[model samples]
Target: MKVALVGNQNSGKTTLFNCLTGMNAKIGNWPGVTIERKTGTIKGTNYEIVDLPGIYSLSPYSTEEEIAREYIFKEKPDVIINIVDATAIERSLYLTTQLLELDTKVIVALNMADILEKKGIKIDEKNLEEELGTKVCKISALRETGINKLISEIKKGDKLKRKPIYDVEIEYLISTIQGILHSSDSKIRHSRFLSVKLIEEDERFDKYQTQEIKHMTGLLAKKYDTDFEEIIATQRYNFIEKVREKTVIYKPVKDDLSDKLDKIFLNKWIAFPIFVVIMFLVYYLSVGIIGSNTVDMVSNIMDSFSEWVGNTLQSIGTSEVINSLVVDGIIAGVGAVLGFVPQLIILFLCIALLETTGYMSRIALLLDRVFRKIGLSGKSLIPFIVGSGCSVPGIMGTRIIENLDEREMTTMLTPFIPCSAKLPIIALFSGYFFKENSGLVSASLYFFAIAIIIISAYILSKLVFKNTSNTYISELPEYKLPNIKYIAKEVWDKVIAFIKRAGSVILICSIVIWFLLSFSFNFEYGVDIQDSMLASIGKSISWVFYPILGENNWGATVSAIQGLVAKEQVVSSMAVISGFSEEVGEGSQIFGNNTIFSSFTAASAYAFMIFNLFSAPCFGAIGAMKRELGSNKKLLKVVCFQTFLAWCLATVTYQIGSRIENGTLHLADILVIIAILLIIYLIVKNSINKKKDKCINCPYSDSCK
Candidate 1:
């Protein structure tokens, strides 16, 4: 038997999925869609479950909403579990009403019941069950409460009666619409709920019905000289308000630590500053303090094992081919990716804690004004925050954003935010080159990414995509103390996903990259190709990156190779070519006296790091962009623009820095000046043109939704 889980945004459906499936869940894209569909099996049961994306309604407005609606309508699961956030039952009920109109059977899982009780909100489960005419299970998916009851309910496989408890006026409207039915049976038969939907102007559902409903409703309206639908909608909302009054009881808001924190954290003037401080603290702990120390210690242990294994192979008369493959190919490749695991854990830990404590949403609210100025809505903040872990999941998080153009732009630029995968590269360069000021380097890189995104959004808003007409309305959920168990589970899930990806795609790519550098058919002999490939490729592309990376630095050389795969591989690729085992600490130097190290100026290294950090992200990011943009042409544009920007930034940095270092200007310096002037001109032209256009004609320019 197959079952599907659906829910509203932040409705705890994912928590339920995690609890039921444990470690058995598999996440991948839905066929022909970028939306991720999580598949897993219920433990010790024959039943399997599919966790569809959390959506507000079964409307074909967004990819996530479409996926949920399609799965239920087409796949026709044996059962559909609609997880509802119990605290905000009124808003959540909107989706519930729509789901009941569908062909599939549904069980309402009222999640977060524990939180509701704690807030002194009372829900009469029996009353709710009778009113909905479906099985209602009050389950706290996070606390493992009422889960057994839910599972047993699902296992029973009983169908409940279908009924309506609508207001009398709405019910009358429904009956009147039903009286005009063209046939007693039509696959596109309109429900009373759907009839009301047409009145409410629900564009998503109105078209799904046959023309009979529209024609009949029009005739009735003309006969009455009034649109009955609008009158009934007002009555339905009134009835819902009355139900809410009886079903929900609210007490005076209580003061808590979370509230106290929010007072300072969410202050309009200081919130941005506080966020900055918090970010610094995150990096300080993750990369500068505890996490960084742990990684160095673990790397030292791995280094010992590497040396021991190398000696053992030497004693056994192992061939250079075997040694390089084992040591350089397998060890260096996988180890390079694994080296950053500690930092990843700490990063995930911080994010999880913040999110669990409800700090992230506050950040979203505080940053909304700033984001709006850049032509993005505050809803995009979730995707940007999620992107900090990995661009793939980050892009997936844009499902929460309701607007198409805003979501697409967010998805396109989100990869610019440095994810955990790219942390290793940043840490490597900052440590090796910049020393203890690594924090500043890392922070500057982050700021650079933000700048790039803001600039891109501005340009895209004016030139490519126009601002969406949909207005943004977000509520700030009252803050509460974060549950430790919830935070730990969230953090651990992220870490596991990271490890799984590393074990699969990244591991394979690492091996393949090792293979490419391992063998080459030379003029007379098949030689190990590291040196030859570096010499050939580096020399050929040396002139292109010379302004930024200098003539022959290994950093530039490895970057060229890494561009074929991912930006993170630049650091790993350099480590391999430099013949460093896992012996290096965060700040430990590996290769090149003044030659490799001094080949490029300090400014050049900074520029090189910035380019890689902001440039198209990894393959995962590209795939995510492709999915979210829903167009190959758009993805290509993003990729091309990122690369172009990286080149321009790098070129200017090298020219200016090199000139300053030598105390003499060169032709490159002149080009850098010209490029800077051109950028300034472009910005001025864009701004002037926008103002002129707005002044000339704009229907809703005053209200930039």
Candidate 2:
């Protein structure tokens, strides 16, 4: 049997699905996280449950709503499990009434019923069932309470068919529309439901709008003396209000804990400061002194293991080439990335803990107030929050935003926030230069990213598109104690994903890097790295980043290019490149005593970090952008814009920071500045030419010209 789990956003539908299927369907306390469906088999049962995207009602005003409506219309499952948020049952039932019009069985799963008493809300389940004409099961998906009985109810078919909900006149009008549909179309799937959609003039059914149906709709509007859409919606809410009066009770009490805490977390003056402090502490613990110690311990273990293998190979009279391949190529490259596993573990744990405590929701609420000042609503923050995990889902999460321009802007901006893939880059630069103060450096980069995003949004709004006002309303989940098992699972999942990449993509890329570093164009083995094949290839295009890294720095140049595969490949490439060639000095690690990056100053290194952090993401994320934008023209434009902006920002940072901090200037900086200015002048010149052409075509051109 197939069951469809449907609900409003944040109503715990996905959570309940996780409980039934034992799958970690990504859960967020805000909207836009799960805008797509996820399916899993219920444990120990033949039932497959599909978790559909949340919608406020059947009306297709937004992308999520359209997805849900289309899924129900096409994939008619055996049962519809509507997971209603018990705390907001009145608001949730607006969708429930619409669901009943379909012939499918719907069992109302009243989630979060366990906490109703604490919030001074009382839900009489029996009364609710009687009023809605459906069976009600109270289950807390997070706590795993009352799930067994809910499953039993589904198995036993404990549900009631819904009765007509609206008044007699409204029902008569709906019946008339259904009769018209039946006469015009013999294959109507859900005549009752389609009739109502026709009455509302939903765009999806435009093809089925016969002249008779249009005439009937016009007559109904004249009879009602109000907008047909408004009257229909008002009547539905009126019925829901009557049900709430009979089924729900509110006891007089003080504000609940969530409301009380919101006062401080959402305060005007201190909210953003608190968020900054929380984020700083999270980074500090994950990348600073504590994180560095754990990473060092892991690095030492790998180092010792590699030494043992090398010694054993030598004692057995193994070929020098084979020994170098094993120790220098594979171990060095993969280990450089794996050593940072400890840091990722800590970082994922901190984020998971914050998410469980509902602090992430608070951060969104807090940021929404500030986002408005910059012309973006809180809806955009959801993508940025998810982007911190990885950019793919973050980019996909933008589908929930209704405005095309806002969604496009969110897509372009989501990647500016540092993702898990970029952690190795942050660790590499900060650990080498900042040392024990690495946590501060790592956290500063995060804030710097936010500044970049804010500035970019402002520029886009003023220069490119008109910004519209959008109010963000999210139902804040009540805070809870951290779930240890959930946090552990989340951390484990991310760590394993990182290791899998190291073993696969990073592993292959490392061997490729080793080969490039090992041979020159003449196929001479053991040649110096400067004369090697990799250097030849890097030098040809290394001029692109000359302003950021200075001239003749092909090692960093190739590393940056290799980052397109996986950001971790940047470090892995450098690790492989650092080991070979006597001219660069042999080093045990990328930042050891005789490091290959010795020529790098703090300013140049940081500028490089800024460039890589803001540049186009890995190919996986680019594919996501292509999928979301749905046009190669837009994708190419976005990628070029991102790369160009990153280059300009990195060049400017290098030119200013080097001159001020080092009291020196390179010829590359002057040339980069001139090139950037020239590009800007050309863009402006093209805009002027376009305007002149528009004027030449105008009817009033003679008066204006």
Candidate 3:
């Protein structure tokens, strides 16, 4: 037996899905999330519930709605749990009507009934069930209310059929449209629900449209002297109004905290400032104060373990090669990266709090004007904000943008924003090179990242997506105080995900990296890198980074080589090079004791940080970009552009710094000039190419052109 959960967006469908399945669940990319589908099973039941992506209607305007529609029509589940927002039944009923048309066995799970009661609105469940011809189950999915009864009903396998509730006028109109469609096109045959959809010019019904519907739609439009879609919309609302009159009762409203808070939070002038302070506080707690300290402590413990392992292996008479792989390459490479899990957990915690409390959406709304000026919708802000967490998920978040052009633009520029994984590298470089002003250095790097994104967006706007249209509309959910239990669960879930990922993918990749930097038959040395193949490869690639880093800097180059798999690996490789010593803290005197930066400024350490920070993201991010961008050509373009841009920024910074430090310009100054000119030329060329195509603002033209 199977059960399917369906609902409108933000109607608590997912909350119910989680509650029903408990820990017996799995989350993956659906069409909206990416990939194909995500499924989870109910524990100890023959019923395996599939949670359908949130959709407004089954007319299939978007991929998510199509996925939902296809699943219902194809798979034909034994029971359907239509999760509805009792408080927002007017909007919620749209999808419910479509579900009724499917003629499947269904029970209405009126979720968020608690919220409705607080709002002084009451739903007559028995009357609704009688009128709609289906069973009604009131549930507060989050609070575990009515779940047992819901489960019992599922087990009972009692099938209920609902005659779709429609007004008399809508019924006549739908009949007229259906007859017209069927008469006009023999090919287009569906239930009356689809006939109404055809009148609305739903593109999905085009394939099902017979010549009859086509001719009938034209005749009706001439008869009504209005577009058929507008006519259908009017009918839908008319039906909703009648149903709402009968089933809903509104009592005297009282002013609540939700309303009071909205006045302050949704205020145009004060909201952004408050939001900025909140964001600063979140980062301060995560990366600056408590979280960083926690991470540092964990890192110290891991470092000690690594040191003990190294010493024990040597004392046990193990070969140097074996000890190096186990201690230096694998442990050192992966541990340095994994050490930041605590910080990530704290950061995710703060974000989850903001999300749960419904503040994140407010920020998006507040920033809509600013975003719209750049030809982006408020939805684009969602991905941009998420980019700070990690570009992979950030880019994935672009799926929220209904407009294809806006989505592409968001995806292209998201990686330019510094993610959590890149934070350690920035901290290391800035702390080591610029004493006391570490926060300023970090903030400047972040600002620089934002600058790159804005400049790139502006440049691309003139070239790539010039013809694309932008329509911005986002619903703002009422603000509520966050639940403590929910916040804890959210934070814990994120932390566990990070730990699990580190243990699996990062650990395995670290081992591979260790092998690459460890194994080699060194015929010349009569051995390898301590007799390893990876050492030979690192040496071979060392020269490639020589101009910016140095030929003898095997460690830096090795870290860069490992950085392809994960950006944090660069720092891990550094720890390995520094001998995995627990004593080596952020401001280690031994390494900087002989550093060349204070004396000579050519390709200085500061410039190196800028380069690494701006360079192409890790392999995982690249793969995500490829999948989101949907083309290999676009992915390659992003990588090349990022590398080139990083080189220019680094070259210029080094040349300028060297001139200031040495009291004279060096020959490398000329290389810096040429690099800057090349970047400018590319930017101009992209703009010119877009202009030639008659596209005024191609938002992603920088890479596309």
Q: Quick one: best lDDT, which candidate?
A: 2
How do the residues 1-705 of candidate 2 rate in per-residue lDDT, one tens digit apiece?
889998888888888988999898877566555788889999989999999889988776667778887778788888889989898888899999888777778889999977888878888888888888888898899889989988887777645656677778779988888877777777776788788888888888798788888887787677777777788788889989989999899997787777788889888889889999988997898788666787668777887899999999999999987898889899989998998887888888887877777888778777776676666767787788778878888899888877777778888889888888898888878887778888999999899998988888876765554555665745676777777877788889889999999999999998899888888999998887788899899889888888997666888899998878888899899888887744433323665555456677777878988888888889988999998888999989889888888888888787787786776777787788789989997897688679878988999988874
TM-score, every prediction: 0.84, 0.92, 0.83
- Which 10-residue window of candidate 1 scores lowest in summed lDDT? 25-34
lDDT order, best first, reads: 2, 1, 3
Q: What lDDT is reached at residue 269 by model 1?
A: 80
Per-residue error for 236 in candidate 3, Å, reads 1.2
True lDDT of residue 51, candidate 3: 79
Better lDDT candidate (1, 3): 1
Ranking of models by TM-score = 2, 1, 3
lDDT of 1 at 38: 76
Per-candidate local distance difference test: 0.69, 0.82, 0.68
Off by over 4 Å in 2: 155-161, 183-187, 369-375, 465-471, 583-588, 592-595, 664-705
Question: What range of 10 consecutive residues in model 3 has the weakest lDDT sum?
Answer: 26-35
Clashes of each: 0, 0, 28
Tens digits of lDDT, candidate 1, 1-705: 898998776676766887888853322111111255777898778788988776765555666778777777767788889998898888787777777765567799998888875666788887777677788999998788998888888877556776564655546656665555434545543355556676455666655455766665565566445566455545445655665776667765576555678789988789888888887777776766654466567667767767788889989999976776677656665566677777878888887766656677788778788778777877677677767777887887777666778888888788778888778777767655676777767777777788778888987876666755344546665565666666676678877876665566556665655555555435322353434544455556667676667665544655544743665566556655545322333334333442244454467777777677667777767887887788998889888887778788777777677677778877876888789989997988888788868866978766763
TM-score of 3: 0.83
